[model samples]
Target: MEPTILQGYELAKQLYAKHGIDVDQALRQLEKIKISVHCWQGDDVKGFLFRDQELTGGISVTGNYPGAARTPQELRMDLEEAFRLIPGKHKVNLHAIYADTQEKPDLDELEPRHFEPWVAWAREQGLGLDFNPTCFSHEKSKDGFTLSHPDPDIRKFWIEHCKASRRISAYFGEQLGQTCVTNVWVPDGYKDVPVDRMSPRIRLKESLDEVFAEPLNPAHHLDAVESKLFGIGSEAYVVGSHEFYMGYGLQNNKLICLDAGHFHPTETISNKLSSLALFAEGLLLHVSRPMRWDSDHVVVMDDELLDIGRELVRGGLLEKTHIGLDFFDASINRVAAWVIGTRNTLKALLRAFLEPVDELKKAELDGDYTARLALTEEFKAYPFGAVWDYYCASQGVPVRETWLEQVRTYEREVLSKREQAAAPAQL
Candidate 1:
């Protein structure tokens, strides 16, 4: 053990003890909180369909950062590099489009064999997996809507795609010894006002009913429906708005996915967790940094994130919440983006665990508002960084910004070579 880390943790332990908080127990609990890292960041949402398809459905990935993973092996290698720098065991989140196969099965025809490589990779990496049904960036989805399209053929196609995704998710849980979450989010809305709004929603409900007709064991899989307020093209109305999913999830005994970026800019997801917990069996959080719109930026240790962490811990909802990151920044190094976003997420959760929740709750309940506010303010300045650094060191990962050096070395040795080989000759 490094003398500095040991000395820092020892002092931090005593500091936390004065507030009746156990630093050691907090560290242990933090280790059990796994943040699922998304795979789209490795390739700017360009999956291995081996097609020249542009992203549709109001979704887009900006910037052209060199070295985006172009193959399955490269994406896996990049993810491996990222996991090494982040502390604690985590899960890999996959999309239906990332399947590794030459057959290029349509979304409706996708089978478990399409994702066997991902399952094998997860096994080798000692990681679990989560999945999403890809309903965008394809020919069938180019009409600006799916699942609620006016045409029954298009809606049925997307329904079949979601059904296949559920089976694949169950397979992941069975093979990896963890409950895999399958989230369904379709871009079905309009850019302008429609005469009738109820028809689209009715169609969406029917489509979702068909997708969830065959139930899978809850022990092996969890079904979640995500909603969005609006997107790039669907500015006028989003069919699967939060209100729609909230009612649907509670009625169907399914998890509701609360994406941080899917709401208005002034809204925060942290405030919604407690309310959703009351009726839903569990909640799935799509943690992302939204800039004005539903722009998915890398997550940072900001106030909103801390509030989210605090809510989970205070309400005892960690066990009932599936924490996953959803962001993709192509302007910078994608691997580093993964490391930064994931580590920050873990850090926020750790800070939540370190809080003197019992003490604060008692004060609030006893009408001692002054003490509650004071303690809350004071806890913010606690020696959280010392504990975070110690946790990282104990996990055999780099402490503090030391991980950046490793990322730089990887870029020079691996990423740069790929870019150089692919660059066009200069005139």
Candidate 2:
């Protein structure tokens, strides 16, 4: 783990407590600190999202937490740290765990054995749940990307999983005591479909509504929709928009999770900013980035951070944003290495926020997207640790030390399992 990030977290504690209770005031100060600490990761421009101050920043840890969690109790704590340490204003993001998502059982664990423990851990640690079940396996979504599939059994199977997860989702709200479903990303859309396509979202909505509608809602859980800026029939939205295949989901009032990274390669930065602004203004949940139009989820730095944050704040979505630090392990940071994965992304976002709006606007207007466009030079500054003094001097926020400690204990437990899973079982 980066010592600087820890120091920043510690400072967050000091500043937050300094403010007594007012969450709004404390949040603004922390935003400034976020800008400073986040920028440390890089020398040039294009800092991190977690590192950014302008956005509703949050922190997240990855892979290691899973392996560290051999037992439910241990797992709960790591997540707790994520919740407590990251702070409410900032959302703690989790990868639905591509590996875990794919870890399907034939008959033994018909239901996720870890389901109860996972939820329990989340509540104990004071963290909300965010996930993308499809990354793991479509066994549950066998009906073909949500409700579109024609198989009732497949739909039933996935619905069952949803029901089980609903229990956990409820815990996040009632027990863990969170608000939104934190980023229920369903990458359930088809790519190879022929001719015209219908709303895959409508199908997904009916399916989730069917499950959440059970008297279990209100008490048990709520569902959120993810609007990915993907494509249709091998062409862009202008040509064949990937989101067109999944845009129907956003229309649902349930909830919306906007992905910053997906805007890349597919659309322009402005388009993505507008979508998030509309979503945030409407009080929708926001997911953090690594989007490069067509690129996969990587660390948030470079131009992506600035583009996303500017739109978010300018759009007035920051106040209502339910930020999730979404990440997918890459060659640089694979799954399970929770510490680096989570911290790196957090630092990036934080840095993005720290950027002065005037300068950013000037750059945007002038189209001086040099740093905004390139990733390498933009992030060339930091060696390993990158905390700046000027950034801190201007930052101030209140921290709930007790709550922070509570979540830290949980993160340790969660990361414990991640440690255990470092090596894979023989097939």
Candidate 3:
């Protein structure tokens, strides 16, 4: 989608003239409206729901997960299958990969000989591919080098993967008419140090430069860069929250793909509100729901998840952005999970897009930012929570208040144990 950038600016300009609003700021902010996914599991939920809703433009996916595809070859098959099953009309990007250094990470072992043809065939079949290595596990990334890893041998491996990923990406672009966006999220940290001491980024950037060292290529264009704020385990190495800035900001080929859930551990990180501020900066979005200290479950319509949708629009991050859905249905009811999740997904998005535009129109004519903001914020919590509640209630579903209490109670117990272990014995 070309995104209504100029139109949005013109609208903002007129609204400013008519209502004395900050048209300049709105217009400036409007330049970075991105609607894309941070992560995804290939499926039809998006096509079935949001394409018609006119909310998101695409979704990101990692085809290797949720299946027995451990090796690169196995993963490629699963990847192809997932893409084929993607029953949506939006762009499909890639995210979340397994590292080679870590105990046979999927795709780490994949040679271009294997990947090149598959990605080519996928293009023939209309499946867009997001090619990159995985992080989050220490075994995968002992020393991070996006384009460059610290170990020379590992660097050699990384360089080869870069070549293959780039080739596949370029191929996808040509065949699909869309850029093969690379979201380079790596875990480049140290176990004993106060911070990620190694200059893994040095190698990472070098590798990236090498990948892009060539002249213009149609098949691949580095679209976005993703960074995270938290990690999975004690002594687990998490690259800096803004590490991608050095890599993507310096390079012309990339954009910033912000994950709202990734920034949750910080109290001051205003969730999706921050995406607006980041939007003004260059690069677009890689949308997703981060499980944050827990399993990376693809939540459908949690309070905070839906809130991210509202923030994206209100912050002007939805204008002409390359947005995608990166959700995980970690629930036992995989099919039902995908369905209700997607149903809620469209509901949340429609509320964000339709209601906000409607309110913005009314507020402009009636001079009611207070009323408009209130209405939007009121629905910010979740677009479909009420409808879901009504449906569940009508169906006589068991109340989840008790389930919620039990989970919270367990968390408290675990935290209390940890705190006692850290604290001195009581007198």
Candidate 4:
């Protein structure tokens, strides 16, 4: 370890000791917490499937950065590079479309063998895997409705796809010795005002019930449902709205996914954590940054991210909450985006863990609002950067801006290769 890191850590330890905060203990706890890095970041949401079309769901990925992963091996290489830069032990979240199979199986026909390579890669890396059903960019979903589609055949197809996704998730857990979180999110809604709003939601409910009909051991797999407010074509109404999923999650004993950008712009998910944790056994968070709507921009160390970490730490819901990234940016180096986002998330969590939670709670319980507010503001000035640097050093990752140079070097050697190969024949 560097002398600067050791000196800075010792000074930070003494400062935090005054507030009854154990800096070393906080570092240990932060190391134990893992943020599931999204695999889509390496490929700009373009899965490994043989589809030649644009994004269909209400989402879009802007920018044309070079070297987007074109194969499972390439994507995994990019992910390995990203993980190398990010500190701490972490997991990777995979979409159903990323299956490494030669046969072009439709979503309904997807099986665990299709994703066997992913499980094998994850096992080799000692990573826990999470799964998501690809509910968009398909012929059936081009109409902007899936589970809630009035067409029984289309709805049935999506339901079967969801069921297949769950089975694959369970297989991942069985193979990797870790529970896989399988989240179902559908882009089912109307573009214009519909007279029969209630009917679509009812159909959606029925479809979900059918998909989850098969019972899987909770020890191996966990199920979650995600809801959205609106999308590009479905601005009028989204059948699987937050309220519907909240109700269903509570009733079905499933994890409710609260996407940061899925709700109204001003609505923050931090406030919903305590309230939902009260009713649900666990929660899954799709942590993303939305420029205007659910844009799925890369996450940063912003106040909203900090608040999320604070809420989880204050409420002691770290173990109960599943933290996963849900953003993609192709404008910059994709691997760099992954490293930046994941590192920032870990930084926010470290900040939360370093907080003197007991002191804050004591002040609140004693009705000392003045002291509580003061302590909150004062703690912000602590040497958090020092502790963060120490943590990175301990984790064998590049400290501070040193990681940026590594990314630049990798871009020169690796990401630039694709651009060179695709360049037009000069003169």
Whole-model lDDT for model 4 versus the true structure? 0.89
Candidate order (lDDT): 1, 4, 3, 2
Steric overlap count per candidate: 0, 77, 28, 0
Give the top-scoring candidate (lDDT): 1
Weakest lDDT window of 10 consecutive positions for candidate 3: 48-57
Per-candidate TM equals: 0.98, 0.55, 0.57, 0.97
Model 4 per-residue lDDT at 171: 96
* Candidate 4, residue 230: how far the Cα is off, in Å: 1.0
Q: Candidate 3: which stretches are off by over 4 Å?
A: 1-87, 91-113, 116-127, 135-149, 195-198, 201-203, 215-220, 233-237, 243-247, 250-253, 266-286, 291-294, 314-316, 327-343, 356-370, 377-427
- lDDT: which is higher, 2 or 4? 4
How many clashes does the backbone of model 4 have? 0
Go through the candidates in order and give the C-alpha RMSD of each one to the true structure.
2.6, 11.5, 14.4, 2.7
lDDT score, candidate 4, position 193: 92
- Give RMSD (Å) of candidate 2 vs. truth: 11.5
Tens digits of lDDT, candidate 3, 1-427? 1134334435544533443444344323322322233223423222111122221111222332222322333334434333222223334454323212223234344433444444554566555555544432223343332334556776665555555556555655665676666555554444444444446655666665665555546345564556655443313444444655534544554556665455554432226345435533344554445543522455456666556556666666554344555555422322323333333444455445434454466776798778877765654543233333332233233222322343344335532243335322211
> Per-residue CA lDDT of candidate 4, range 134-160, in tens?
999888999888888899999999999
Candidate 1 lDDT over residue span 312-367, tens digit each? 99999999999999998999999999999999999999999999999999999999
TM-score-superior candidate, 1 or 3: 1
